[model samples]
Structures are given as C-alpha cells and as structure tokens.
Target: MGTQQTTQDKYYVVVAGDTLSGIASRFRTTVKQLQIWNNISDPNIIKVGQRLLVAKATAGEPQPGDPSFVPFPGGEWFKTLPTSPIIEMMGLRLVEEGCGAAYGFSGPGPKWNDKHRQAYACFQSALGYSGSDADGWPGRKSWDQLRVPFPEEGCDAQ
Candidate 1:
C-alpha cells in the first residue's frame, strides 16, 4: 500500500531560507505533497514569495465575514481598504468557489500575499471581467457579490 501524505487546512508562504523539505517538515506534509499542491516540476527550486498549499481546506471554512467580523473599529469597507480579517474572510469564499489557489489565505493583517492575489483574480474572473479588468483587485460589484459589508452608510450597492 502507498503511504498517504498528511497536510493541514491552511497555506504556507515560502520565505527567504525555506526549503521544500523544511516546509514539508514544518507542515507535517511530504515533499511530494508540496510538489503536487504547488505544481512544482523541480522540488529543488521554489521562490521566496511563492505560496504552497500545505493542507486540505475544511468544509465551509473561512467564509466571507459578516458585517460584524471587521477587526477594525468601524466597518469602513471599500476599494483598497486597509487589510483586515474581512479580506481574509473573502479569500475563504473564493477558495470554496475553487478559484482559490491550492494554497490558502495569508496576511489577514495589513499586507497582501500571493494566495489572496490568486483568489482575487478568481473573484474578478467569476464576475465576467477579462483582460486587465480581471486583474486581482476589488470593486463594488465584487464586494457585493462576495457580500463584503459596507464601510459607510452612504455607500450604496453599485
């Protein structure tokens, strides 16, 4: 019987000194699993900023956050809003739709990661945007589609 590799329900980003073997060990996954998850043709090579799917996603995990999930003081959602758990929650919904990279979400704080970018692209594509429109960024249509809460009272659905 072939031994099965185990992984977590999250994603891991490659850092400056990360190795496939090291990552596999850190996530308790096998190098082969990492290769398959990230489609690495060469296990010996991985970029520092590359995202790796180290685990399987949970059933209905990390869905888009409700209006109350905002980690900030007020729910001021909008295009180019500061990063927060709200963004991470949207990323989860993207994963459920299968546009999420095999990897998972990261930087639920004031930063961005490849995982989110890929998922954002998926969201944009799903919204019928193509060419440059599909670039991995947010818009009112997507915010409504993804159910991101309003940042202010005057902001109506576009």
Candidate 2:
C-alpha cells in the first residue's frame, strides 16, 4: 500500500511483519526520529495495524542514513520448539552473518551454549544496544528483530 501524506508529514500502517528499523528504512528516516514523532518509547514494540506519522525532513533535517542499522537474522522461529530452537536459530544466523568468528557454528543443538550467548550479544551490540540492553537476555525486541522462527507447536515437555 502507498504511504498516506498530509500537509507536513507522511503516515504508514504497521503490518504483521513491520519493525521500526524497517519502517524507518522504507521512509528514509531514522528510528529515533520516528520515535520522537510518534512518542514511542521502545523501538521494537510497534503494534500491527498501527498508523504511524512520519514527519517530512526539511533541508536541514537529519537525512536518511544517520545511524546505519545492522541487518537482523532474516528468518522466523518455530512456535513450539522441542528444545531451545530459538536460541539455536539465532546462533546459527549469527554465524551466517560472519559475526561468530569467536564462537564457531553449532546450530539446532540442544544447548544454548556460550557461543550462542556471545553471538547474541554481538548482535545486540550491532543493533546499538549497549550497557544493560546488550546483556544477552534474549529480550522480545531483539528476538523480534532476530525474526525468530516459529516452533513446532506443542513440545513443552522434553
């Protein structure tokens, strides 16, 4: 669908798979600018079907590509995993992204090994999460950005 435009800004309807970064990238704006315009506290907590206003950048406004965003894992997680497939998938994706030189590669394994955590933290840091945000806690924001694959659907007892 086309973005709606107003007198001084544009608008986008959040879809099922929309992220602030993705949206900002599409609109040629920054996540921080979108947040400031929309009063969003968390860049990762956008609701589906939500209409977001994008203020049009003037000549002096910070043009696109202010803070380049690192790409996240481009995959979905299983809904009902037998084990910790989510972590494993993230780890695998990290290695695929060439950020796992220190961790090597061992995805779809049973354990959320040290390599997994290190890769996850690396991902967080790349996404600009420093301090406590990059604590490798598998937060929803990062997980969403990671595009966690859907689980097998009913494997809570392994």
Candidate 3:
C-alpha cells in the first residue's frame, strides 16, 4: 500500500525500489506508455528523483480561439499541404490518443503523408466517426476535437 508521489497529478517521481511496471500499474497505464512519454529507451534504468509525465495535460482554463491555441486548417488543407509543424502536433495528439500504430517505425514526422491520414482516421474512429466521415481527413470538428496545442516556438505553421 505504498502511496504514489506525484506533482500536479501529471508527473510521478521515481523513488528507490520503484519499478516501471509498478509505476504504470499504479497510474493505470502501460509500461510502454511510460517509456514513450518519458522517452525512456530502457525501462529498467529509471533512477530515484526522476520525474515522469504520467498523465495527459488538461485543457484547463484555455478555450478555443485563444491566441495560443491552434486553429483548424480546414479539411482540404491536410490534403494539399506539404509540411507544417502543426501537422506534427496533430500526429502527436493522434498518437497520444492510442493511434501510434499509424506511424509505425517512422513515427509522426513533420510531414503530411498517408501515415498522417491513417493516424487521423484512427483518431476519428475513436471519436465514433465512421465511413466517409472518418476517411482520415482533418475536418473542423475532428481537428478541434484533437486539441492540438499551439506549435512550438520557431515553427511557422498556423
């Protein structure tokens, strides 16, 4: 019955005797997820005092159309687009939603490709969309639902 030590309910600090599986079990997540979130290539190497993201960041008080929020670039935009940091953010969101399989070994790179569409389709399916609606296109509804954060600094995508 060891209590879990966390910060802001988002991160967990590793303590002596802590194991990745134990932490994942306590957090109701998977070890693979812990590895992915923390970028830990070796699950056995977590050290004491190490901080790890155990939960997704909540939207909190931020609302749509906020200056720091990313707006939908229209469904067609995902089709004809070349590359944008926004797309990378979208793919990251999709992967966060359990659609990482779409990217496979390549991952969600900063490119608009079939992998992006496949991941978007998984996201749309997760939202209960089907058929043409979930045809892997980034519609306004799904785009907003994805809740892509504002692009990182130095990224030119809107």
Candidate 4:
C-alpha cells in the first residue's frame, strides 16, 4: 500500500509494529510530546491507522544532535523487578537439588552454576527478602511468594 499522509497539520502515520518510541525517535520528538499532542490518554493503545501530530517546526526547534528525541517507556508503572531471574533460579535449584532435571544446562558446568546463583540473588532482591549470598538458593517460599507491583489506575496523571 502507498504511504498515508496526515491532513490535520503535520502528523506521523503509525505503521505496523510501530511503537511510540520508534516513531518519536524518527521525528526527533518524545513519546510524551506525541501523547500530549494527540491527546493520547493510553500510550499503548495507538493503532496503525492513527495520526500523531508532531510539533510544528519553528526557528527555535531543537537541534538535530540534541538529546530531545529519546523515547520514554511510558507504561503505567516504573521498572519493576524482572520475573525471569526468579523463575530461572527456581528451575536451576530444582536441578541442582536433584528434585528435577535441568532443561537447558548440559551436565555439571560452572556457567550454569553461576547463572543459578545470580538468578537466586535477583529473586531475593525482587521479593525484598534477605539472606546470605552463600546460603541463598531458590526455595519454595521465595519462588511462590514473590510479589510484584501492580499498575494502579485512576490516580492523578504525572
């Protein structure tokens, strides 16, 4: 299909697989600015057919090399702890403890062992649980009782 043009002022067309970040980067703007211009309440809800109004270029526009185009990860929450590390640690401990066979690790290797320990540490930090580095291995309590911050809606917009 041919490129779609914006009629209401200068706007950018949302393409397939296009994220607000990617679009902002291309146009030397920010995701926040795009959201504000388009009255976009939901940053994640932009569709392929929506037109995003970029700011009108004026004489005082930001220079090309300026750091004005970085796209923010505009989710409802800040970066929380990642869950993969916790899961990996649990799986690794199961293998090391002879409770289950490890899927990705082949035989006894230092890399796998180190990875398991790292995962355990991450899991501890995420759950706000504390333990000695040497003694902290994946446990049922750590894995099962991990709590993540949920996105709270209807709060005042920042």
Report the error of model 1 at residue 54, Å: 33
Candidate no. 4 TM-score: 0.34
lDDT of 4 by residue, 1-158 (tens): 11223333567788899887566545544555677788988767789988888745444433332223211212221123223332333343334333333344453232325445454455455446665632435443443332111122211112
**CA-only RMSD, every prediction:** 13.4, 14.7, 8.0, 17.2
Please say which candidate is ahead in lDDT: 2 or 3: 3
Which window of ten consecutive residues has the lowest lDDT sum in model 1? 63-72
Off by over 4 Å in 4: 1-9, 61-158
lDDT of 3: 0.73
lDDT of 2 by residue, 20-97 (tens): 877864664456658888999998799999999865634342422122222232223322232454455556555544
lDDT per residue for candidate 3 within 21-98, as digits (tens), equals: 677646644566689889999977899999998755544543334344477877677777659888887787676667
Residue pairs that clash (backbone atoms under 3 angstroms), model 4: none
| Predictions in order: lDDT | 0.56, 0.57, 0.73, 0.45
Model 4: lDDT equals: 0.45
Residues 43-148 of candidate 1 have per-residue lDDT tens digits of: 8899988988876654432322323222223323434454654555555545544466634443233334556666778768866898877776665445544543
- Name the weakest run of 10 consecutive residues (lDDT summed) in model 2: 64-73
TM-score of candidate 3 to 2 decimals:
0.59
Q: Which model is ahead, 1 or 2, in terms of TM-score?
A: 2
TM-score of each: 0.39, 0.41, 0.59, 0.34
- Tell me the number of clashing residue pairs for each predicted model: 2, 13, 0, 0
| 107 Cα displacement, candidate 2 (Å) | 5.4
Error in Å for residue 38 of model 4: 0.7
